[model samples]
Target chain A: MTVIDVRNLRKEYGPHVAVDDVSFSVEHGEIFGILGPNGAGKTTTVECVEGLRRADAGTLEVLGLDPHADGKRLRRRIGIQLQESQIPERLKVWEALDLHSSFYDTPTDWGRLLDDWGLAAKRDTPFAKLSGGQKQRLFIMLALVGSPELVVLDELTTGLDPQARRDTWELIERVRAGGVTVLLVTHFMEEAERLCDRVMVIDAGRVVAVDSPSGLISRAVPEQRVRFRPSAPLDERLLTGLPEVTRVSMTGTRVEVSGNGDLLHAVTSVLARHRIVAADLRVDQPSLDDAFVALTASRPHGSGGSPGASEGASDHRRG
Target chain B: MTALTKYELKLFLRDPAATLIVLVLPVGIVALFGVVMSPGGGDAIETFFPSAAIALGLGQLGMNLLPSTMAGYREKGILRRMAGTPVHPAALLGAQLVVGALFALVSMALVVAVGVVAFGFGPPGSIPAFLLTFVLGVMSLFAVGLLVASIAPSGRVATGIGVAVFFVSIVFGGVFMPVESLPAFIADVGDFTPLGAFMRALRASWAGAWPEPLHLGVMAVVALGFSLLSAKMFRWE
Candidate 1:
């Protein structure tokens, strides 16, 4: 079932358009990522989905309820961890959880949440005293205390250390494991690649593409490169003539082969026939970071485009 | 809503400095002055000490502290965070008002206790009139504080504005001196101001009479007007 459905969502700040004609849907029980650079309207888009902002033009349905019209009811079932939002500095950890739980009709037990989120030791600590990671954990715990069916986490790990980011990712995965749908907004490609079941790439308030991590990588960059140091002198023509080998270049004793479709097998089989050992072999497949750069960079500029225009054309070609 | 108010009360108490200022300062004022004045001397000027003490406490809570705290909540995005939940941000605002009122009442009680028991100062001349005037005074002062909170862009700015307004109100409202000694024109002008009217009404009730209609009307008008303006201007973020 679709948990969140937003179509042609447009929001503006006076003359400055923040989100323009964006469209996407999050499926139930899956982590959906909205990936974009700063000022790309990622936060504005989710703010609409969370029913915090009224879209100037568009339709948004969360759990089959209109977000703006049924906001009070919608808010009950969806937990939100907003960017730059904070608890009172003097409020204790347990008090925040207990207080927020009272806002929901059927809240989960906060004591268990404290244990689950590893915050039991810090229960008495004031919010200002917690380290960044602990504060983040408490926020996630508060988000879950409402027993929500879906949670919207906006830049949850933006300021954390690398270890804390990894730990937060694991916690997010745990949230999904409990059958709650998650909508994660992030600019980090690795985060989306690791945790998102599918990602919607938005740029300049427009939808660039929507696909799984690997799907995006493959779609944006179809070719892979293989680098190896050959033990013996190699003929350039032998690799150039192969069907999978699009280009082959020699750098000193190192051979670089680039192509699509069975390129590794094709090049390795050729090396075997020549009886030349391929040393320090490395297969460099394009990563999500590469795909993100390629997709956003290739977007057309000037003359504001329609929502998902390029996404539609790309889908047609893929089909 | 009760949970929100309880937590808000806890948060207020956690700040020892603020709690001390709200409770200790007023009681301390009454204590210091009660010793010097030698109450029950049958001088009406004795009323100035207790009334000024209570007014000072309310002004600090409503004018200096409340605006800064509420603005800080907006500056820190606490209000915005609550907006995403099942509860409205207005509930938080209401909780703050409730907490502030609670502190004001406690502080007033402490001032009265110290005045009546330790100094032999008489109780309010009319209990019902005193209560009515007290309620109006709190509403008017807090309404002005909410207005300050609404217009200020940040917590620091709100604190600056609150302090400025507080000093001005205390000076012109007769907290610094008895209104009877001020210039006739100044006293007349003070009658129209919220704090000025509040002090007069409080003094009237303590002297065993109902507050003047002009004083009551001034407090009511300021309370209603500022409340509506703040509600219209308040922002979640």
Candidate 2:
């Protein structure tokens, strides 16, 4: 079932259009990620989905209800953890969860949530006294206390350390395992690659691409690179002649072969025919990080929007 | 809503500095002046001490503390977070206003009790009139506080503006000295201000006489006007 359906979502701040005709839908029990750069429209898009901001022109439906018209009812069924939001400083851990639980008609057991989120020991600690990871855990727990069918987490681990971020990723997976759909907004390529079932890359108020992590990498950069040092000196023409091989180059003793389909098999087969032992071989598959850069960087310049136009102009100058 | 209000009250009590200023300070002021001025002599000017004490507590609460707290919530995105939940963010605002009013009432009662029992200060001549004036005073003063919270960009700015308005109100409201001793123009100006009108009416009720029509009119007008203006200007985030 489609959990959230947004079509032609557009939002503007004064003269700046923050989201421009963006559209996507999140399926049930899937981790959908909104990936973008700093001023991209990722947060604005999700904020519209959460009913925190009104769209200038669009139809947004979460769990089959209009976000703007049925806001109160929609809120009860969807949990949200907003970026840069905080509880009262003096409020204790359990108190925040307990209080938020009261906001819904049917709430999950907060005590169980305390234990589940690994916050039982810090239950009495005030919000200001909790560590960064602990605070994030508390926020996630608060979002779940209402027994929501879907949860939207915006930049949930933006400032967290590497280990803390990995831990949070696990927690998110657990949330999905509990039969809830997750909408994650993040800028971290590895985060999207690891947890998102599908990612929607947005840049400068426009949708760049929406695909699975590996699919995005393949779509953006179709080539694979294989590097090996042969025991004996090799002629480069043999590799260049293969159908799978696109380009061949030499760096010191290593022969680097770049191609698209069956690249490794073609290169290794050619080396085998020559009785040349291929030693210290390395196959480099393109990562989501590379795909993200290629996709966002190669966007058509001067899209007319202020942010995109300015960024495009600067890139043009730099080039 | 009850859970939210309960937690808000807990947070308020947890701040020792706020509790000290809002609750204890007024009682201490009333006690100190009652001993020194010997208000039991039944002179009308003696009423200034206790009435001023009550005004001080209410002004600090409705002006200095309430604005800072509400603005801080907005600055911290607490209001925005609440807006994302099933409950309206206005529930939090209602909780805050209810908590502030509770503190005001308790502080006023403390001042009156300590003044009458421990220091032999006279009771209010007309309880109903005194109650009416107190209610209006709280509404008007808190309305000003809401306005401050509505306009200030952050908590620190709200606190700065609240404190500045607070000092000016206390000075012209006869808290520093009886209105009779102030320059004629200053006293006349004070009668039109919310805190000043509140103080004047409070003193008159304490001395067993009805307050002037102008004083009541000023308080009523300030209450209604400021409340309407604040409601129109309030921002959820």
Candidate 3:
């Protein structure tokens, strides 16, 4: 079932347009991600989905209900973790969880949620006394206390250390394992690549592409480079003759082969046949990070073009 | 709603400074004034000073306590957090009003207790009349505080506005001096103000009579008008 559907969403702040002509949908039980640079309208789009902001134009529906007009009904089924939200400084962790639970008709067991989020020991700690990671865990626990069908997490790991961020990623995976649909908004490309089932790359109020991590990488980045030093001198045509190999070059004992598909495998097979003993072999496949930078850094031409508009529209290769 | 109110009360109790300002200061004021004003061998404390004590407590709560609490919650995004839940953000606002009203109740009780114990003062002559006037008076003052909370951009600004309103109400409403001591025109203007109307009506009820309709009417209008205006202006920012 489709959990969220947004069409032609548009929102502006005075003269600054935040979200313009944005459209996307999330299926049930999918970890969908919205990835973008700062000021790319990612938060604004998710805020509209959370019913915190009214869209200036277009339609938004969550669980088949209007997020704005049916906010009361929508809220019961969707949990939201805002980017910079906070509880009272003196409120204890358990009190925050208990208070948030009271808002739902059938809340999850908050004690179990605390354990799942690695916040069991901090239950009695006041909000002000907790570290940044503990506070984030508390926020996540509160977001799940409702046993919501859909959880919207915006910038959940912005300031956490690397270890804390990895822990949060695992917690999110557990949340998804429990059959909750996740809508994650973030700028961290690796997080999106690892966690999102499908990501929509947004930049400057426009979507550049919507695809799986590998699909995005392979499509936006057309070439991969393989580098190695050969034990014996070899003819360059022996590597370039393969169908997957695009080009081959050699500088003294070092060889570099660039291609689009199965280039590393074909090159290794060629080296084995020739008994060349490729040493210090390395394959440099393009990553989602590279694709994100390329997508957000490039600009479209003509009047009213988005800064992140892809070279071609309709580049949605869903996997 | 009950759970929200319970947590709100807990948080309020946890803040010592707020507790002292809201619950303890009224009792202190009543005792200090009793000792200072009646040092010599004199009759029991008169009705005026006790009534003034009540006004002081109510004004402190309405102008100082409620605004800072409401604005602080909004400034910290507590209201916005509640806005995303099945419960409406209005629940938080209602909870704040409940907490403020609870403080007002304690302050009033302490003021009366100090009057009875330290100064040999008796209960108000008509119980129902006193309770009615007191409720209306508190409602008006809290409504004015709600208006301040709605407009102030930050908690500090709200507190500043609250202090400013606190001084104006005390100075003009005869908390420092009896209205009769002021010029006739100033006293007439004071009669329309919330604290002035509340003090007058409460004193009349202390003497065992229904308050003047003008005082009750003024309280009613201020209560209704400010409540509506504040509700209109309030934002979940």
CA error at residue A30 for candidate 2, angstroms = 0.8
Residue lDDT tens for model 1, A1-319? 9999999999988777788779888899999999987788899999899888899998899999999899999999989999999999999999999999999999999999998888899999999999999998988888888999999999999999999999999999999999999999998888999999999998778788899999888888777999999889888998999998898888788889999898999999999999989999999999988888777664544333333336431211100
Q: Give fnat for candidates 1, 2 and onward, in order.
A: 0.86, 0.92, 0.76
- Provide the TM-score of chain A alone for each candidate, in the order shown: 0.94, 0.93, 0.93
Candidate 3 local distance difference test against the native: 0.84
Q: Name the docking class for model 2.
A: high
* Stretches > 4 Å off in candidate 1: A300-319
- Over the stretch A1-319, how does candidate 3's per-residue lDDT look in tens digits? 9999999899988878888778999999999999987787898899899888999999998999999999888999989898777888999999899999999999999988888777888889999999888888888888899999999999999999999899889989999999999999988888999999999998667778888888888777878999999989888889878998888888888899999888888889988988889899999978889888766654433232333354544322111
lDDT of 3 at A134: 84
Error of 3 at A77 (Å): 1.4
DockQ of each: 0.89, 0.89, 0.69
Residue-pair clashes per prediction, in order, are: 0, 0, 0
In candidate 3, the residue pairs with backbone N, CA or C atoms under 3 Å apart (3 or more residues apart, or in different chains) clash, namely: none
Give the clashing pairs for model 1. Answer: none
Better by DockQ, candidate 3 or 1:
1
